[model samples]
Target: MSDTMSETNRMTETETERQEGYIPHAKQVDFSSFDEEMLRKTFPNSVATDVSLCAEGVLMTARSKSNDPQVTFNISDMYRAAGYKQTATGSCVPFAPEDVKTIVLKIKGSTSGLLEFFYATGSLTTATADCSVTGSYIGGEDWWYVMLDLSRQRNGQYTERFNNGCRIDWSTDVQKGDTFILGEMLFFSNRSEGKAYADSRNKIASTTIGKTGYGDDMPAEGVEAGYYVCLYQNKLGSDAAGVSATFGTTGLEDAISFCNSRKQLGYRVSDEKGNVVYAPYTLLQCDILREAKYVTTYARENHFTYGDAPINPAINNRAKKVSCDRLVCWVMYRVGFTDQPFTQGVVVSAMHTWSEENGFIEITDKNDLQPGDIILVKPNGSGTYALHTFLFAGAARQKGMYFRYDHGSDTRIMSHQPNVQELELPGAPFWRAYRPVATATNNIYYDRYYAD
Candidate 1:
């Protein structure tokens, strides 16, 4: 948020940094220390007099007789397209059209006028734009974060014509003295690096899954092709209703029963004196448990049962029994990290080894874990290395503990058995965590089809 001249200066990446896939581009434009010579070198076509650096950001003032003021960013060097010359060279490598996913802009100005964006194809002087999107400002003085999803643009061929650069057109509603400020402009690539992967995972986790099913209502395009779990494939049978049934065992069902018995799991637990007591779970933990329950129920209901197949078939095969590792694979595939339930070994130990060999970095501290991180558990009361795998949902009800979406064991026919449980972190079984390297790929389950 700092508008300091030094902080708003353009970022330059070295050859090694560009080669390493660093997203090299302009961070902010400081008008206060405006350099007309550098602006000409960078944009070439932009009018230096149209904008000035303000205390907040780059402020643009409407010119007399021009109702629709605009700003142009000639970013030919940042994109690979035909018929365009790079105004500034050697700064960074141009990205392919498909590599770019979204364009985010932070702006604040007139609330009445529309802020329009246009992506020019071959030339900026063209009468028509290849693609365009319209957005509104937040009015007042608050910044509005507007996101334009390039993939959803009307012109599918826009990528081919991405050479001319892009323009922002303010609506004619502005008067001569009307003004607006451009805070930031960022172009996000489709490549599965840290930010891109985290954004995709967060979007999927928040919008795709519901309390009742695992993306049952999600569009086919929203899911990774070939690994799409159809609505019919996610059936929570009567076994889901058995959570309230008495079970002498101490696994998933028991956990759910205990949670139900004391509504105090996620809420604050108070003493008889009505004094403040410890809160076992956070509200986020409660929401995670609700969603995890549905995932567990669906896995138990639809996985390939014993003797149902020679081996566990692909998830698309609509088999009925899913092991803990396969369940993790399903979660990853749903999150667009893999194509199918991981093609790596089906056993927990082999998957754990594959994770280590691949770009999955090990995390010894549980506090470093994120919501979508993969959690590997050592066998309880034994020396077995990796006996189970699940996702680190989020923080648990208890302090210093986390929640996990676990498909407890391989297929079991018992109606009282819970395939998945939202368990506290490192309580019953010690856990080792692995954070996936989003950009890394391998011949096994880690493929670029989903990541890209």
Candidate 2:
């Protein structure tokens, strides 16, 4: 394929994240109607991931680029996750609507782990748990995504029902252009309490979602001053938590528990100093399906080739090439970070092969595979099955029982008939089961870099 077609096809699925006005969570509140503009002002410093609303509830994502083994955000006034637009109205046009039924929050990382997601409101000066969020270890790409249901309660007071020690502060009403902060504030002593891996959003402030934030007050040590956020979004936390109570709450919470209970630094959402507001982070009601498709399509469209692009390419000009996206997604699915978004490339490159020895399928002589192992299948290269990668979700010895797989070409993950197509493999086809492991390259810093 010519480079022009390759470039155009690749850009097809990519969407530019530009600045857009925030929309309120409430139906009656039209943040878009007002002629509001974001005012420039310095933010307070604290340590803890915070979450709030600007025109609406925003999603935040981030990563750790540093070599630090562990980090956290635990201060007041620090925005663990937040979004706001300073309005000339002088009145707060709340980001999150009082009647908002739910908020779905999603996050991810490179390792199979868990992260803590917190929701806090009111002045960062006074810290309270608006809501505590989490994403479980949904394998493969070390990603996590969950939904928070805030619509259940009309009152602002935090309720014990969801373990969120937060209640909408009667003192500060939600407002437009009102400052919504997330992830560490600088007010507390320990600033490195909350940190996220990678984040994205369709609503919330562009600054707060996937990165870290900062405030003026500096503590003796730990973390730095600035907006340390991960991702941002609009309307609803999104993901996992559809528009249901029983299903979302139970399923999401249960998933989180399963991932966190494990050993890896696993917990949904980064652990920050914010209050828990909702429960059972389900998939975002807005675009869960669309986003899933986008991720899969992006992977299929763009691929990396090591030694010059493949020659003669296979069918559809799909030469033998490695796909990190497919592998990571499958691994993540097996591990448990379900409903999460993964865009970054995988840790290892995929291998392409062309052979006629075996029919178009490269079958391994070994039968050792587990629930969370990586399953690779290459076409004998005769153009039979071409090339494919499967994430092992489950395996059964029962008759006609195929290994559970997540197809990199499609959006769904499932087990299917083994690839009949054959491809050349100098050695045995690689189908080794792998457990998610954390590596030094896995960690990334969201905000400013720390001197080593």
Candidate 3:
């Protein structure tokens, strides 16, 4: 046999592959930018229930079956989107187990059994060709949480066994055809004997079936309470997955009323006039006022801003809002901030400044400020010397807080700040921050990237 054939056989027999064992030539050919839209078209596994382009990288959610809902996705698709391709004969991306430090799955599954998640790590040698599966238990029910970080591995391969699973991985390759397969959030069941169907109790409660899912109709506690009202509910019935709902009279009425009430609080409410209205700043404050917590500290301790035109920048930006503001608002509103701006600036920024030099302070500049850092401010006031500051908490509402609070209405809570001019600097900062937060949702403007 030739010398090359002999060397390959020896290495395979001994599992002695080194990092420099195979030096593949780097191609010099240029190609179009990695197009996620295009990359998704290549594989059956590309479709995801949710897809998000984040600071760390692209994140996607797909459905599968196992002990519960299992999620899987591929690094290969990301690589292709990043402009890499798989060689014709190659298995695709050749990844060492150590390269991946974290793997997470936001799961929803049956409670009876543990959920198993799998990943396809194309191997460099035939002896190591095997899939890796990771398992976890979400107890029971359709719940969600971050999964394991199997960065630690034995050898250059990783493997786990379970009844069923799905996974998401980042591949090292960027070429077409040669890509890793990925999936996310799959449902797994305890009974491995056959498919697990929803029990009779799994059906949407008959009381909730036709009634509006939000407002007083929903439970005060638990997963089923509150409405995620969608303005387009009437337009897109069952087909609508994100926000659209099917209930008619009550559903439509509740949605409209909620939006209209919040319209005064810088929250955007779409109208037939082809004009978008903004809520007022006071409304944001009042939202917190209503949700006042006894622990008050935690609830408002890390509060932030929620508009395009914040009082300042740095502390009052978008990232902070999504990670903090919006989440808190959703939680408190669910807990009982039924009034306008249900969870507005005050409550949103409540936790901002607890000490002497604290309160919501807008930064005239963002580039100079670091995230999670506090924002300080000194607003002009009639008092001797006004120096109040709120933590530069963060931005919660993107699309720059819109509501009926026109400056003309001095009593208005949520107010409309012009998208351009006057609040430009502060508003501009909010838009940049909102870009990433808005991308998290596959809502109405799903096709459009973040916009002011």
lDDT of each: 0.44, 0.27, 0.27
Q: After aligning candidate 1 to the native by TM-score, how far in Å is the CA of 82 from where it should be?
A: 22
Q: Which ten residues in a row have the lowest lDDT in candidate 3?
A: 189-198
Give the best candidate by TM-score.
1
Off by over 4 Å in 2: 1-270, 273-294, 297-372, 378-387, 394-452
Better of 1 and 2 by TM-score: 1
**Candidate 1 accuracy as lDDT:** 0.44
- Candidate 2 residue lDDT tens string, 11-120: 32131112343222211211222222211111222232232234332212222111111112221111111232222322222222332333332332223332333444
TM-score, each model?
0.34, 0.24, 0.20
**How well is each residue in 183-265 modelled by candidate 3, as lDDT tens digits?**
23211211111011212112110011122221232322312332322222221224331222211112323334434333222
Per residue, candidate 1 scores C-alpha lDDT tens digits across 116-152 of 6776634544424447755443345545554555656
Model 3 off-target regions past 4 Å? 1-44, 48-166, 171-346, 349-362, 374-452
Q: Residue 316 of model 1: what lDDT?
A: 51
**Whole-model lDDT, candidate 3?**
0.27
